[model samples]
Target: MSFERLNQINDYRQLGNTNLYVSPFCLGTMSFGTDWGWGADRAESYRMFSLYVERGGNFIDTANHYTNGTSETFLGEFIGNLRDRLIVGTHYSVFTQRGDANSSEDRLRKMVQSLETSLRRLRTDYIDIYWIHHWVFGTPIEDVMRVLDQVVRSGKILYVGVSNTPAWKIAQGNAIAQLRGWSPFIGVQVEYNLINRMAERDIIPMANDLQMGFVATSPLAGGILTGKYNQLALARQISVSEMLARIDCTTARASLNQEIGRLNLHNLAISLELMEIARQIDRSPAQVALNWLLQQSDITSTILGARTSQQLEENLGSVEFQLDMTQIADVDAINPTDSGMLYGDTVYSEVQDILLESARVVDLNH
Candidate 1:
């Protein structure tokens, strides 16, 4: 709130338990291309990339399927000479090959093929971090780990990360890798934000326990946390529901609407509280929301996505200030998951007490 302008971007933080360092925020390139009709053109994308690099941002995230491959191609051009200085991370397991049913398979063959294509598109010899885009139900965890380990051994990818996977599965895979002396996943990417605290129930804790880096995607809740929908609707003199109805029925937009529709009364109340806090602090709602994520101890870095330079600059300002304990508690109080009896802190604490009390008891005979 009313934070002094950051002369530059925040200092680098270690990526998980790895020696590699990345900025406080990773530049997400999902909107780097205009194929989606809602993203930045090549020139605007280049400008955003230049500004981020100029401000000392070195970590950039992109998926092979992002924008039909334009995102990776554009990033390849933008990072020309700076390749050595930046930590380039890209994901796989999403089909980009047209009319290839087998391409969707996350087997060793598909993984290799996908990595090869990503390397060619990015114009790089190796990816700093390679992520499995999502978990495939039929694939064996051992096979995935073995292939990932082989990729690391081949010097094709420096590290492996998993995204959109269940906590127990990742734990099992990593344990297997440890026993086999294979490369374990060093990072985790997941949808994490004020509204989507579901990750906190398991994913976040699992990553912390395993010493894996946690990267939060959709930290803005698909722009809802920015309060843009309400502002845009108000500007057009329409109700929120009416504005949402006017959105194009593209697959991406529909998915976003589905996520927003999940917002119950508690979420709306939290949004209002967030807006009030932003007002009291004299900061933009987006900045306040992002700052809260950056302040989280479990988050190694929060991914920031923007289609324009102004939006990117505003997101960059998030790292400039700290949210005090009072502000954090205020926001925490309205969190959607905090009210649940099964998952709330109250029950967790009680369970911990019971476990600790049981641990302290021992029979003299034993």
Candidate 2:
């Protein structure tokens, strides 16, 4: 599709009055290289990156630890001088070594230096957004925020976000920053999808209360919701000997649960339903899933990874169309929220009925 054909998808919202404009979907570069076991090569990665930019996508997400830095390397090469057009986010503090000690204050500085190395690899002078990849045991939150503030002040990173940090810790860190008159985190990155709604337990409500931007990663549950796998059919079709030769326990189970559970819930087959939905909407299932996320309130973006240009293209169609209430509720029924918690006050009060009273339906109209 041509760039002109692509909608601008201006689903922008203020991140606590930060004056930052962002789309509701962010392109994830985790599959830029094969270091994490499966990904595209340099050529394919470039193609996907170009396609994403051509589709009016400005935000890009990656990690220093993804593909042993190859993801950043590809992004660096791909972005070139057009870096100003990109709101790139990369992370640190993930478990790099099984037995090594976690990052300390100095270690966090080293990590930021390593991020500079990533900047070199990315061929950019500064990162648009930087993330605390995860909370390690040794680094204090105060120390981490101090470094983040320093980097932001130095113009090394335009915005800072935290990933996988607890709600209370984020609250405390922001409170400290507020008290000290320092820059607090403007965004949060976390695993949020139909299956992994765990962040809704605390993170979503906290972000809502603080007016922080929330970017959801792993929205597909690692391809489970794509309706691409068929464990039952594969098991039935393959002979015992052939199955033994080629069967994968992990992939098969992942496929089976998504397929069977979807069928059981919908009273229809998974692939058929997905294909039907795609046919009716002239979109791919990946697009539908991404649109489901993009339609939610308080969401800044949904990060996506594509090993091929085709996958990226299919996923980008999500921006072209949207899901209505009936469609969203169908998917939501398959993946219900943990509606038991009261979000704003962090109380365990039942607020579903009251909240639903004001719940607006998602659609093209609004």
Question: What's the residue-level lDDT of 242 in candidate 1?
Answer: 74
The total of clashing pairs for model 2 equals 2
Q: lDDT of each structure? A: 0.78, 0.68
Runs of candidate 2 with Cα error greater than 4 angstroms are 1-16, 96-106, 231-283, 339-366
Give the per-residue lDDT digits (tens) of candidate 2, residues 177-274: 88887778888887777656767778878888888988888776666567554343454785333533444545433444444342232322443355
Q: Model 1, 1-366: lDDT tens per residue?
A: 122222235577788889888987899999999897679999999989998999889999999889989999999999998999999999985532454434443657788988999999999999999998866544568998999999999999999998877788789999999999999999999888887787777878888899999999988777777876566667899766676677544657546646446433445446667888888988888888888777776788888889898999999887677778788777666574542422222333443233233233233555
Ten residues in a row with the worst lDDT in model 2?
Answer: 347-356
Model 1 — which ten-residue stretch has the worst lDDT? 339-348
